[model samples]
Target: MENYIVIIAIISSIILFLSAVIVFVRFYRERTQFKILLGVALIVLLAGSIINVFEHTAILQSAEEFEQILSILFLPIIIFAIYESIIGEQLRTHIKSEQMFKGIFNQTFSFVGLLNSEGRILEANSTACDFIGYDNDEYKGVFFPETRWWKHSAEEMKNLEGAIKQAGQGKTVRYETTNIDKDGKIHYVDFSLKPIHDSRDRLIYLIAEGRDITEIKSTRLELEKHKKNLEDIVEKRTLELKTANEELQLKNETLYEKNTIINEQNAKLVSTLIDLKETQTQLLQAEKMASLGVLTAGVAHEINNPLNYIVGAYEALKQKDTHSGDEEAEMLLDAIKTGVDRVAGIVKSLNQFSRDTPAENEECNIHEIIDDSLVMLHSRLNNKIEIHKNYFKDSFVTFGNVGNFHQVFLNILSNAEQAINEKGKIWIKTTKNDNYLIITITDSGKGIEKDAINKITDPFYTTKDPGEGIGLGLSIVFGIIKEHGGRLEFESEVNKGTTVTVMLPQKGMKHE
Candidate 1:
């Protein structure tokens, strides 16, 4: 039994040594008193075990004695651990509270200054330094009233002195004060000062804060001036209105006679406007008929050529000997059908161009309108003009009476054809620019002189020999483009060419 006791003591001593080593490691890592106490307890147990096993056995041989010894050592260690925990908690709380105070003080947008009880600045935050245009070193230990911020206005400085005195008495004071900056520029601030006291009820410092309110001050003054002006205007307008009422009552009979005259004049004016509108529309119709009249010879030629082709093809086929698997008949029929379709297209274009009533406004591609106009002028320009088309592939969409667009293109193109007495090239370019479609028609022709360019689109103004053109074509075009919220501009130099630019807005577009 004594030998067994020795072996148990040796095992117990090993556990105590390991526990002491772990406790000391924790003590070094945590720097806590609890770990130190745990380390000392483990070491004391390890020493008791070693002495029982190697030196003496009677004292630590019993479990009860070992437990009693551990209890005696652990009581004081527990108390120390509790005490150390409380102190650590207090230190952590103090650190967090200081961080919070510093965050609020430095990060606030308002100017904040910590002033000693004597109203001298002890510390100024970044905002305060920036606002005053001074470094921290410059303002430290400087009296609030002695700073450069109050240099411009004595009244503002007086107000500041009163606030400081109130704050020094442990009373909070708030007032507006004008502050000057490094450049002596005046600014208003919503200024406030409050007394801070220590736990012993002694004044520690004064916290001065100010938010910029210069714009607010200016606005208030403007509002007051406006109010005064409005009151004066109301009084003056009341007097004028009272006098005018009396005059109005006296002139009732004269006003009644004048109204009667005005009504009659208005009726005549409205009638004249209606007549003018009808005359204007009639002139447009007459111009379309005149265009058709010019195309009559071309239309006849267009129709006759196709008809003659069909006749010649038909006669040639009839005379040919019929044979099985002959390609001759099929080829002649295809030629005849093509010619027939060409004739049919010319007639259809003529019918569309000769509409008796104006077409309603519709969404249309300007390129399609240009194509139809070119189709109408086809016979006239077939071999004479080389047409260069640079049209927008996506198409420029605009809202307007499609017929009016047709008329506009027809008129411009007709002028172009006439301008070029011989063979030439005509370039038609369509492009987009910021809610507008720009169409540029450039014709290599005999351009008008600078003096005549101004009068080109004028009514009844013709550069053509008197009978050659009535000169209403471009005038009508100008009126149409203008009514569509668009403009027509011409750039020309004699014998070089003329470029007619048309700008049409794409928004809120409709026929007028």
Candidate 2:
């Protein structure tokens, strides 16, 4: 029996130690004031177990009194210590909660109230009292269903009754409503309702948190006004841009009209200039004719006397004896006939020059004209210079003034001949392809420089020794060809050669 008791005591002692160890471990981890009190209890229990071990029993002769002393002394100490810490923590928590509630409640302009399930006012923050114009003590048991907040409309009373019923049934209800204050000014409030339940899961009260939305409504109106003002500004700017665009278009149209007028004037001026050049060319040709006429008249008078004497002498030989009219007399008559024919030809050429009508228009071979011009220049040409005639097999003919065309060929040929200063060749080539008659007069002469080529065809533009050329030849040719509705093309290389091509539309051809 003693051994069993001892075993039971040891087991009880181990259980107590284990309990103390668990408490100490938990206390050490938590490190709260309550944990400090629990550590003291564990120490006292540990001393009690050690004393019991020496005594071999939990009770001694004074065991009851000792237990009573420990209970009276240590139990109160442990209880008092833990109780003080719990009270302090709970008090601090309650004070902080109250302070936070007061801070939030003061800053808010909304109403807040707490009601019990009986619909009686249980608690009311300051804003609630201010909104309802009542003190906390004045509405402690006042049911909100009977209050003035619900007195305005039956619908409001029904909504309030529904919210109370839902909260009593342990449900949260949230909605918006209007309420008139003590001053009879209606206010809109958005209120959120939360149900508070007891430990038994029965709803005991409902927390109503209300927020005033008057400022939000005012802000919405201001934003609408600003939007209207911005729209007006955009409309005004759009109108301004439209006006500016119209002005720019008007200016552009005006500028285009002025430009068109100027272009028309320029065209008329160019036509007048071409006409003037043609008139000037005609006058120059007339002057050359007058000079040639004076020269031809003097030569004709001198040749006529010589021709009359030769005819007289040939007749006298014929009238003499038939025997005397031998081989010598026959040769004299032939000589006289040749002299008379030559004089007649010179007179015909002189009469052709004196005629002042416009050049005769006809279809003529360009190659034949070039050959005739070469024949006239053959005696005067430099002996060292070569001549190349690459005439087309088929004749190139155009409907134009033949005299004018001939003059164009003569002027260009004369210019090419003068350009050659040393032993060089003159190349004349005629080509007919498509609708164009291309006549190229090339000279192996000092070619035009780059800077001078642009203005080479301009009137008075010349690169020749004084008294060798008057520079009017090419200008006259340029005018004549232009009057025939043709163009003169020039291509040259410095110190190499120069080529002048006159392109005219072929006969019987018309522009499509």
Go through the candidates in order and give each one's C-alpha lDDT: 0.81, 0.73
All candidates: TM-score: 0.42, 0.37
TM-score of 2: 0.37
Please list the residue runs of candidate 1 whose C-alpha ends up more than 4 Å from where it truly belongs after superposition.
Answer: 1-53, 57-83, 136-138, 198-201, 225-233, 253-512
Stretches of candidate 2 off by over 4 Å are: 1-278, 290-293, 296-355, 382-384, 510-512
- Residues 1-512, model 2: lDDT tens digits: 76675676577668878877887787778767776676677666655554555455534544544545554565766886678688968987999999998788666666777788788877777777777687547778888767766577788878888888877777778887877777887777786778888899887778877777766767878999999999999999999999999999999999998998999798897787677576876655664564464675577667778877877876776677873648876786677778777566555444433434554256757776666456445655749568888887885887666656656776778778777876889998888878788889899988888888777666656888787665666777777777677789999998888999998878776223
Deviation from truth (RMSD, Å), model 2 = 28.5
Q: What TM-score does candidate 1 get on C-alpha atoms? A: 0.42
lDDT of 1 at 117: 94
For residue 167, give model 1's deviation from the true position in Å: 2.0
Candidate 2, 121: how far from true, in Å?
99
